[model samples]
Structure formats: structure tokens, C-alpha cells
Target: MTDTYADLLACEDLLLFASAAISSTGQREFHSGAAEQRLSLEFLHEYVHGTHPDLYALALALHVNDHNAAAIVHRLLSNPRTGASAGERARENALIRRRLAEMPPQRVYRLFARLARERVNNRRTRATMRAWIAARPNLDLDAVKYRPGLRAAARHARVALPEEVGVFLFSPPGERRRHRYGSPLLRAHGRAHYSASDLYDLPYTVAEGFAARHRVPRGVFLEGVRERATRAERLRLAGTARRHGVGAGPDPAAAPLLRLCVYVLSLPTAERRDRRAELEGALAASALRAAGPAAGTWPRTAAVLDDSYSSIGSPVRRHHPLAAALACHHLIRALAPDSTSHWVSGHTDPLTVRPAGPTHLAERILDALDTGPARVVVVSDGHDSTPPLLADTLTLWRRYVDPDRATAMVHLNPVFDADGLGMRPLSPAVPTIGLRDPRTLPSLVELARFGEGRLGLSDLREHLRATADAYLEAP
Candidate 1:
């Protein structure tokens, strides 16, 4: 019984840390400032790593955001391995490799730069850094785009670079101007200083700097760089591109589901209404793609979505919580097809749903429960107000009305509640999971079972091991 109780505590701790890891990026939320968020996150990372180092490492294989993943890698690599078997260390190393590969190039470069700054040049760290940098498809492009970071990483890792690439990165400005580079991108970078035409051949981010240096007109530079911009870049610069009289940017349908939702919410209500057909069609298609095989799988689903004022999030992450809710709203509908969404403010239109009124989650929960959905998914920051009866309602519903536990329910919180040290739970009766992206909703719901106290620590470990194995095995 003592061992069981200990396992239960460990499970709870893991869940709590996972929630913070997935949702919090050490940025300010609606209620918490950046400092508080960072401090809380740091404490949780240390506590979890001390308590369960293996589970802490396994989180990299899960849906942890890039920020926390970098932190996890740093923490794991900074410390020497002890007590773990050879197989365990190998699994941890594999997890790190996969995660570093999965992170965006700029972020990984930044992580490498950070490791260099911290002087974390252990054998494992050096090998990991060297391997990742050596794996880059185009070191010339990296040198041009992320010169300082690439140089720092190479120096710290002691990894040798191609001669021209090394000169492009390490040579002084005068020396680079005197020398010629074989790589077109590297040559373009050197020429971009004096030649406006050469800037277009470089990546948009690198070209932007050269364009500014050359005093090129914004319109002309934008036109020239349009072809060089990535899909995500085009979407991000759509408004700017339009203001400068570029074409109607990229198609909305090309956006990933979560990014598209954020973009849709960023637009004014009138614009969203005007482009309702195009936007809705794109959202439906993206959500369907994100749902994949799970699309239209669950029947009679209901979602109690929070569009309360708190969903406005902080200035650093404007409408982030609401964006998560909006994305999940469409995803749940796609997943169940017949899923009903009940907004806390009683708003019906998902497109025009904005964060305004106080959170009234209890009433929405009651409305959703009345519909007898096979699954009740609540997407909120978990800040229920106007009497705060969400806990009681869920508790009583589970105890009296749903004693058989036929209806499944899970709370997905997009914002981390620093005060709670995890996602603020609607109730202990319902399992709450931190959600960063709507695409991971299905798997996250499945993962929430351990938090329900029914699954032991061994079961949780098995799940983590399986997840890590699959993650490593995937191409």
C-alpha cells in the first residue's frame, strides 16, 4: 500500500510537470508575468529531474514545446549519468538527438549558441552538437543566415567546417570581402553588402538585413524576396507584403491548422466575416488533415470552449489561449463531426469568437453534460468564475449522474497556471492535460489517464518507454 501511494504521488508529479512542459514557454500568461512563469518552470524542471530523471528525460519524446525541450536537453546533458544502465543512457541520447532534429533550425542553432555560452562542452554535448551541425544540408545557408550562432557552435563543439564555409563564418569582414566563395549563397551573402540584386538570392531573414544596409525600397525588396520566402514566412509577412503592394500573399489553405487558427484570430472580426467561406474551408481542411484517421471517429462529442477575457493572454502571446481553443473547437468538430461547442460567453459563431466576457465554464459544462456526449472535451485556461461551480458540477455529475463513467471527459488547458504549479484543473474528478497544439489533442487525452490515479507508476513508465521507442523508431 505504501509503495502504491508513493507511485501515485510520482504519477501526479509527472503529470504536473508534463502540463507545465507542454504549455508554458517561460513567457508571460494572462495572469502570470514572465519572471513568475520562468521561476516556476525552473523549479518544476529541477524537482522533476531530481525525483524521476528518466521520466524527465522521456518528456522530450512527448509533446513538450521547443523551449522546454531545449531546457531538458541542457539539463540532461549538463549532468553526468549515474545509476542508469547502458540501455537507459542510449535511450536518453536517442531522445535528445530526435528532439534536436525535430526543432526548427533557428531554434536549434540558438540552443547550440546557448550551450556554447554556458560552457557546457562535455563529451556527449560536443558529440551531439558536432553531429547536428555536420548533418546540416547546407552549411553555407546556415553561415549566411545564422553566422554568429553557427560560428559559436562550431568553435564550442570543435567541429571542422568546409574551408569556404569556415572563412565565411570566422574570417574578418575585410578578409571575407577580399576572398571569393564557391557556394552561391555564401558568395551572395558577401556581395549583398554592396549589391542590392545579390540580396534576393539569400534567405529572407538574411536578405532583410542586406536590403536595409543597401537602403533598398521596402516594396522592391519584398518583391525580389517573395520567391525566396518559405510558406510560413509568406504567411507571416502577408499583411506587410500587401501594404507594400505585393500579391495576395500565400493562400490561407496552405497554413498548418494551429498557425492558421492564430492567423484567423489575428484578423479583425469584420475581415473574418467577409472571408468566412475561404477561412472556414481552409480551417476545415487543415483540421481534417490534422485529425487524419481520427477524423469523424468519435460520435456525439461536445466541447465546452472558453473564450473568456483571460483567453486574451498576455501581450507577448496575444490571443494564444483563445487561438488554442479556436483550433480545438474546429478539431473536435472534425473529430466527431457532430460535436457541439458551447462557448463560455454563449457565443455560437466560432469564427467571430473573441475573448471578452468573464469565464462561465460551469454553465457551459452543464449544457454539454445535458447533451449526453460520448466525450466531453473542455478547452479552457481553467479560470472558472461567476460562482466557480465547475468543480462541484463535475464532482456531482461523476458521483450521481454518471456513476458508470460512460461519458468520457478531459480538460485541456492552453495556459499554464503558475499559481497552481500546473494546468489549473477544473476538478480533481476530471483529468486535465496541458495542450500546446490542437493536433495533439487525441493523444493527450489518452495520456491523461495516468493522472486519474487509476494507473500506477509502472504503467506510466511503460507508456513513456513505448512512446520513446516509437519516437526513436519513426523516420
Candidate 2:
């Protein structure tokens, strides 16, 4: 079971879903009965009771209304043995609050009132409730049983209590409160539900208004808004967010601008040149640059980045693979400033290759090996379009360049190989490591340390144990 967990962690296709089952970091863009089946309460409970409560917290966030989830929440709230720290509890509550704001107004009121009754009043929780209530002037505050306490607390804290909270919570439930306007949180959620095509036509003011009204951190919601935004609207949103100190609306790991870059790169050569500056600037501003090499004697490493058309994918390409490749290229350059030994797509220059061609892993490997570097690393999706000669090239590289059979080549796959069950290695001699997140570039350094061969089970276990211990030890 533990081995399965470890393998799932390394499996890109499963990791996010697995991670989401236990943690809030998982992608919840698609929420349906089918998606719910991917994460079971039993699995969540086990993880919640295990070393990674953060994972379960995320799962709970997604399945907050589930009976099993509610039970786990009750258990966690009552017991300290769930492995959740003070910080983790606070984070989960905050996530729940944000999710509540995205739900219907009546649902939000019910959930908030339930939490208030249960006394789950963290600072962020109270503040979020206050923000929602402040935005909705027509809500019946009497529905909230703890209205008096909340009102008193707001008054004592000199917080701006809603005018309707003064009227309805103090009056009978039969007499409903009326207002001049509707619920802003519900309105925001409504605005957020616009179809992709419909979103482009809506004025940017709608998005800005939602952002201004909602205090809860709706990053995922904001990201969706930016995704459907027009080029002009995207730029406008970015500039507005910066001015308002909200930073970028989208996740930097899979930023919309990066996808736009990939889209622009796919255009005709003459057209692509026009957007090169924008593409380069966005890449530079991303979190990838921070994964720069440490100050030390770097190894003689050659990195081959895949900028193939397959890497960018079809329909909705997040450009994550291309981004990871660029990140690796930047990492290598930062570590070994003097090393000009790297390839992207067919080009030897990493920056010159746009994601526009078919994959030729054999050619890239041969090119890198020809340089006689101590280590050859290929960053690809393992979807070689040219030929099945990658293994032959690895064999040749191992035979001539590395007669001692030292670690000659390593394949770092940014995209998970669903059919292969795990990351695919070109040959038995050459091992593969999953590069789901660019922050794991340090793992590349660990591979560099394995100067003579693949990492064994013991080696992998030791790394996992250390990681588990470190996460458990963190506050």
C-alpha cells in the first residue's frame, strides 16, 4: 500500500487527484459525480489518520458535504491526533470559507451559520462571513442563530456590522429583511459561471467588481476568469491586479500567459516574432527563475528540452511541459554559467526552439552525448515521433562514452506516461524521474549525485522516509 502511495505520488496522471483527495492543492476545476469517485472517503480517512493530514484537508475541502467527509471533519475538530497542526487547521478553514463564498448565497448563509453555531470562528472565518454579509443587504440574518454573538463581537471589535444584521437577527424569523440590492457573493458566483465564449463578451468591470467585493481568496475562480479573458482583458486584469496588490490571478505553474505563448509560438514564423518579447518577459517573471542553481562547482551536465508540438498538446494546452523544459534549461544555465551544452526540440539553443516540431529524442540525445558531458539529461514527454532509436542511442552512449557504465543519461519526464504505469525510461540503463513540479529541480541534483547508475529501492525509500519525516516535523 505504501509502495502504491509512493508510485501514485510519482504518477502525474494520479498525483494531483491523489493529492487533492487529501489536500486543498488538488485541482477541483471539474466537480462531478465521476470526479468524486476518484477520491474515496476510506482513502481520505486513512491519509487523514496517517502522516499527511494536509492531503485529507484538501479532500475535505472538495467533499465538504459528504457524510464521510463531515464525519472526518468532526473527528479532526474534536481530536488532535488527526495529524493536523494549528496552521493546517487554519488553512483548511480558510479554504472552506473561500469555497463557501463561491457557493449559492443561501448555501453560504447555511454553511456560515452552521460554522458559527459550531463556533468555528477563526479570524479568516469571521472576516469572510462579515464580508459576505456586508455584500448581501437582503439576507435574513435571523437565519443565523449566533447573530447576537456575531453582532456583539463586531461591535466590540469596532468592525462594521451590516445594517440588516441589526434589523433581522433582532427580529422574528417570520419577518424577513428586505434590501435595495442582491447578494454580491451569489452575483460573483453567477458571473463566474459564464461559459468561455460568453466570458469574452462580458465587460472586465464584472470581474473587477467581483474581486473587489469578495475578500476570500478566490484564486481558482480568478484564474478561470483570466483564462476566458480577451488578450486586452487579460492585460487589463493583470495590470489592475498589480495596481490593487492582488498579484497574478492565475497559478504561476500553469499561467494563462504561458499557454498564450505556446499558442503564439504555433503561429506562422513571421507572426510569432511579434509576441516573442511578451512571451520571454512572462517566462522571466514566473517562479521558474527562483529555482536557480546554487553557488558551487557544478557538474558537467547537458539538458535537452523538448519543445515539440505534442508537448504543447491539443485543444487546451496548459504549456506545463514547455514551462518545465524552460525551467530546467534556466536551472542548468544558472548552475553552470559556462555550459552551452543543451538542446531544445531540434535546436541546440534552448531559447531559440519554439514548441513547433515533432519529437526526435534520439537526435537530441546523440547531440548532447557528442559533447562528451559527464551527464546527459533529457526533459521530454517520452512521445518520440521520429523513431524508436532512443534506446539504441542510449546503448551507444553507454558503450563508448561511459564504458564504466556510470550514469550516462537520465530522462526527466514532465508529463506522466499514463499507459506506462509510471515514468518511462528510454532503456534499462537510463532511469526516469517524474518532474511534475519545477520546484523539484533539486531532485535533478540528487540524480547528479548518483554518478554511476540508477537509484535503487533502498535509495528511493530513504528519500521518501526523509521527505515524510520532514513534512511531519513541519508546523
Candidate 3:
């Protein structure tokens, strides 16, 4: 089969598989393409119902190489009967959009071209093409090779191309030749966006040249180069950045500068110590208030901040779960005067606690909740290394210290659970939320209320959707 046809078939098969998986109430098998075996619809149903987030991620990755699969993903996302929550579906949609944006617009246009011929009546395919076109208005509209298919798709979709593109498309071969901007090959390469991943395979000088040509911002430049730079090279880069006013501007709102400093500290300890004052200054400036709680209309919150090795082991520095946990602690303490903080490490004082030792979570967590705080929040990776079983401990806490279970207890996990599929609840009693973006903490609390029977997934989804919509609409 031709490449376009194969891609179309793959997309169709994936959509069928997903639809079958979702529609299965208890059936064991569904014939999908050549695959003729039981794939455990029960597990898949459970997975989509909120057992794991990874399954959806896996589904995305399965046919990611095929641009047509994006249409399938869009369809899967819109299917209301699927077990995935509205928030999960929205997150998947966002992921697909980002992935689409990262691709060369030509490829997306070509996919549209192929879909136009193969699935002429597909409204989703046409809508998807229009979305990509709208996102990249800077792209040359007439750059695509397969003119007839794309023109048909655009016409059917009622998509109005720019005047120049429309003129080029309709004009005869000689006219098109005259108006052609440049070698399509060269233009395609020029339009390919380079990201931090580009640094891994390319030479440093080449990457630097690409960044300079693109006028990539200082923070992005640092992220692109940090892992590959030598200690001395990093210092030199920092000095140059300071001189050029690259990263020397006033702090932006909700800046994660503290986490960035911790990433800097992750370099050889001796090399990092020279900038100790700078790190300290960032921490101080970012804080809304000094240590200790402030008066406010806040609940008596209790938090067990996990400083275990896992939190510090995040692949992305900006997402250092430990730093995020510390930031959360500071924010809660500053906002809620009656709050108590528990640092889960080998220290009594919260400030002195460091991320060491395999998490001895069950005991420390139970002890924190036993204090009778109005609400309990556990920021962890949900790994109880030394445990009289976390679930058992939670049972004990509920039985004695919290018979009424009045406290809104939540497990905020920043790490993706590859094993459990989604963020795993520490116990059946506590709700676990995937804390991928800490800014979503406000809406995520509703999940805890859902677990407590005070709310539902619909409520959590509404709150999350509002938050996402507001962010999108923000000036």
C-alpha cells in the first residue's frame, strides 16, 4: 500500500480499537483490523475510568508517527462514553495540539491533503486542518505540493486562504511557477522549529547558531544548553547572559526562579556554592512572606512535604517535584496562618529537612494527620518504602484520629505513575491527583472533595475546564 493509504488505515484501525475498548461493557474480544485476540476490555475500561493516565499517554504514542492518527485522537477525545474524565480528555487534546504545532506545517497540510481524498466527508479532519492553518498563519499557504487535494479540502471546509495563496493555487502551471517563493525543500527545512531536544544530537556550535538565528529567549537558551554545558561553560554563559540582559529582567509573576536555583545547585556542589547568595536571594524575593503562617480566611491545613529522593529526581529541573513541594509548603504557610508543616526526612525542623533516606511515609504521614488539622495534604511520589502498609496506616488514622474523616486529605503526586498508569491514591480513603502543573492545585482540591463524597468528577472537571479556559483567554 502507498504511505498515505497505510497511514489512513492505521488511523482508522486505532479509532476502531479505541471505540471498541470504550464501548465494551464486559465483552472479551473485538475484531480490529488484523488483531484478533482478547485485549482485556475490562482492564482498558478500568484504565480509562481513572485507574491510570499512562494508558491514554500510551494510546497517543501508539500511532503518533502518523499525522492522520491525530484525527483519531480527536475523535477519541470527543467520545463522551469513554472512561477518561473531561479533564483527562482536555489534557489529551492539549497534548495533541502541541504535538501538531511542533510538526512542520507542510506535513500537517499534506495530511489534510491525503484525508481530503480518502475521507472527503470527514468533518473532524477538515476542522483539524483548519485549526493547524489558523495556528500557523505565518506559514506560506501555497507551500504544499499536492494542490488539488488541499484545495478541495479547503473549499469543503470553507477555509479562506490568504490572497497570495489563493492566487497561486488557482493560477495555471506557468503562473504558479512564476509565483513560487523558493525551493520547497529549503523552505520546509527553514520552517522546522528546533527545541531543546535538538541539542542532544547536534553540535553545540550548531545549536547555538540555531538559537541565535531564531532569537530564542535567554531562559529557553539556558534550558537548551544547561545539560550539555561544562561547569566553567555554564558560568561563562551566565556571565554573558548577565552582560546581555538576557535573563536579568525583573521577576515575572509566579516565576519558578526558586526551582531554577535548585537546578543550578544540582551541579557539582562545590561549583554551585559560589552562587549561594544568588540562590538565597531568589528564594527570599519569591516568597510572599517569611516563614510561619499569616492570618487569612484559610483552613487549618496540615501538609507532609515529601523531600524524599524521588522528588529531587525529576528529569526536568523546572518540574523538580521537591522544589514544587517546598514552594507549595511556603505558599500554604504564608496564606494559612493556622497551617502546620511536616518535613518528611530525618529532621524535626521543616526548614532543616533535606531529601534523603528512602521514604518512611506511613509513620510520618500518620503522625502528621494525628495532629487533628482541618485538612491534610500529602505532597509525595506515593511510594511508602518503609511501611506498615500505607493503606493500613490510613485505615488506622481514619479509625481513631479521624473517625468522621472530616479532614480533606489529598495526595498530590508530581511524578507520573508508569506502574499504576495514573496517579495512584495512597489509600482508598485519600484522593490522589496528578500534580503535573502545580498551578492547577486550586482546582485539583475538588478531587479530594470528590473522594470524600462531597463532590464528583464532573465538578472537578468543570473547575479544571474553567481554569484552563481562563488561562487561554488571559491577556
Candidate 4:
């Protein structure tokens, strides 16, 4: 092939891989099984790394899910030769550190454990693992909560631990029970196996096993742990807490937008209705927080949201697609107060939207376009019940109705099409970007310009480089 054709092909391939990274978390989707998802994702990662190693490294800065982020870190760390130059290697190392810091503690520990399992015990791996473990704000909490993972990582990386922590982790069970510990957290953990009261002092996740072993009453355990639970832990345990008659669950207002949307959808319809005021207020506030300075800026924007049955997602994800659409619904409302929303099922209330209808995307597209907005954002999995009709509709609208292209459209798909190894686009006329987190909505929309074929491969490389630099420089 000619040089231009090769560059175009490379650009398309990179975009496809990027979309997969953003949407696929190696989990089952509505139409694809978990194994298929994993296989496709692995293949894409390999292809992208082989073809465009620099862009693959830069993808760490994008809104990739935890699974892909871990995978990227593993690939880069395991294969030092992947970086062709000293500067490239430094950038990759910096990106790895940033991504690792952004991930949850459990995930970072798990990544370290995986590295140990794979026997990837290179000098760089050892240093990175040791540094991360040493930098943790509370190693005592990690020892209690993630004992096995922390122990394995420390051993693999040969990370020296605090004197008390070393004994707490490596001591035999008999010795641990007999020896007195300096750290209160460690002392509680050692006593938790025999003492129920001590379990309350430990993190809730670690305390639960001991609580069960002691056969502590669920209600009592919950009440005891309520004061100690973190915000995220409280949100997760709220339903159980309510069932057990613990204080009214954590306030919804403090939750992040995407998480709040998922939490709301996890509740039964009756509870959601009963808590309508609280939930709606939380959603609105979270959306404003997510939008930040960009809130209420796009007065002429419209959204075509999909609430079809396929959006029910898989058991693993549980209403993930619908949740994304719901989050986008709130975000769009916040970003453009006057924007029109056209749901596929014609559902007017965002709070009670359930996935239970055919994907009539063509009609919704038509409705959105009729609003005469400057931009139209379509959030869907692109599984239209009537094949080709949505594409045909957009084609006709773009060709005859809006020949001047006054209205711009982009599709943000949350479901990964495993068979296709990328997002299932509704129409070639519109750019389809993968949607993972609602907070990244504005940036992803701006990124749609690259997917529209308006920019060349050089522009994409430049964009990735600039994005990497900005991310590394950010606090």
C-alpha cells in the first residue's frame, strides 16, 4: 500500500483500539460473553501495541476502565523494549505511575500480585512495586484489608515493611495471636478472629469475615461499623444497613455522578420512587459537579438517548448501558438546560427509565434533528432492532435535509461490540466514540473531531502526545 493509505489504515486501527479500551472492561456485555470480550480486548491490545506503541502508551491518559489501565501498565512494565527511545521510556514510566495512582488501592495491590504470579520480577517492576507500597498513606489498613495481596506483593518486590507491620504480616498464626502488636489496626486484626468487638475497629471489608466467623448479628455489626466506614464503603453497604435498621444510608448527594447513577439503578423501583426527591437532587448536584465550569453552556444542544432492552446490559454490569444514558441525560441537562432529550422508548422521566423496548433509534434521531440544535449527542449501544434503518435515516437526513451540515451528530456507545472489536456505529455519517465515564463526556465530544476523518494520522499522534504531556504535568 502507499504511504498515505498506510497512515490512514493505522489511524483507523488506533481509533478502533482506543474505542475498545474505553468501553470494554473484559466483562460480559448484553450481546457478548465475558470470554469473548476478554479475547477481543487482548487481541486489540496486542495489535495496538505492535502497530502504534507510542499511542498505546499514551492511551493511559484516556478514560480507560481499570481493567485496561492495569493491562497497559502490565504490558509496558513487562516489555521494556516496547519503548524505542529514552524519552519514550520515561513517558511510559510516568504514565504508568499516574495510572497506578488513579486506580483504587485494591486494584493496585491486585496488579502487583498478578505481576508476582507471572514472575515478572525485573528490577523496574521491583522498584515500582516497592515505591508504590511504601507511598501508601496507611499500610496498616492495607495489611488488614488486603492481607494476602499485600503480603505477596511485599515478598515479591522484597519491600521492607515497618517493624510492627512486618511481624503482623509474616508471623505464624499462633505467634500472631500470642504477640502484642504496636499498631492499633494490627492489634485489632489479630484479635478479630477471637474478639468480635475488635472487628469493629478494622475496615468493614476485613471486619465482615470476622463478623461472620463470630456469628455477630448483622444489625449489630452494621451499627458498630457505621462510624468507621468510608464514604464509598457506606454507599455500597447502604442497602444492607437499611435492611438491618442502621441509620439512614449514606447521603446520595456526596456520590460522584456515574457512581450515583449506577447506585440509583441498583435499587428496586419502589425504593427509587420513595426516595425520588433525594435521588433527583443528588443526580442534579452530581451532574453540576461533573460539568464544572461547562455547566449550562450548550444551550443549543440536543440528545438522543437509548433506553432499549439491550441496554439492560449483562448480569456482570447490570444496567450499565442504561446507566450511561441516564448519566448523559443528567449531564446534558446540566450542560444545556434548554436542550431537548429524545429517548428511544419515549420515556420522559429519567429516574424511572427501565430498558424494555425496541431500539427505535431512527425515530429518536429524527426527533433530535428536528430540534434544529447546533449539536446532537446520541448515547446508545447502536443495537437498532431494525437494521440499516438508523443508518439510512441519518444518510437521508445528512444528504437531502441537512446538505449544508448545519447540525453535527456523534454517537457515544457504552457497550463494546466484541465480534467487531470496537463500538457498533449506527451510521458512518456520524462519529462514534466509546463512552465509559460520564465525567469525560465533554473531552470525548471534543475527541469526536478526530473520529470524523477531518484530521489525519499526524494530527492524531500530535493530539496523543499533547494529551500525554498535559496529563503528566497535571497535579
Candidate 4 local lDDT, 272-356, one digit each (tens) = 8998999999999999999999998875888999998998899989989999999999999999999888899999888988889
Cα displacement (Å) at residue 369, model 4: 0.7
Whole-model lDDT, model 3: 0.52
Per-candidate local distance difference test: 0.89, 0.49, 0.52, 0.88
| Residues forming the 10-long window of minimal summed lDDT in candidate 3 | 28-37
TM for every model, in the order presented, reads 0.98, 0.50, 0.54, 0.97
Which 10 successive residues of model 4 have the least lDDT summed? Answer: 1-10
Stretches of candidate 4 above 4 Å error? 1-3
What stretches of model 3 exceed 4 Å from their correct place? 1-121, 135-297, 314-319, 347-354, 370-372, 453-475
lDDT of 1 by residue, 184-278 (tens): 88777778888888899999998998889989999989899999999999888887887899876788887889899888988889999999999
For model 3, how does the per-residue alpha-carbon lDDT over 1-475 read when each residue is reduced to its tens digit?
1235444433333333333332222211111211121234323333443433333443432222333244434434333235567776566555556556665545656555655555554544456667766666543433343456457657656788776566556667556545644544323323323444444333343456667767777666766556655444454366455555554432322245334434443445554456556554555444443322332545888888787766554332322567657666755665565778887784654333346767777866767777777778888877777544888878777778678768768887655443333344577667665453343345456434544434434443354445445544435
Kindly indicate the candidate among 3 and 4 with the higher lDDT.
4
Residue pairs whose backbone atoms clash in candidate 3: 52-421, 52-422, 53-421, 53-422
Local accuracy of candidate 2 as per-residue lDDT tens digits, 409-473: 66776553333334445665565665544545555445333322333334544554454344344
Error of 1 at 441 (Å): 0.6
lDDT of 4 at 377: 96
| Order by TM-score, highest first | 1, 4, 3, 2
Return whichever of 2 and 4 wins on lDDT. Answer: 4
Q: After aligning candidate 2 to the native by TM-score, how far in Å is the CA of 208 from where it should be?
A: 7.2
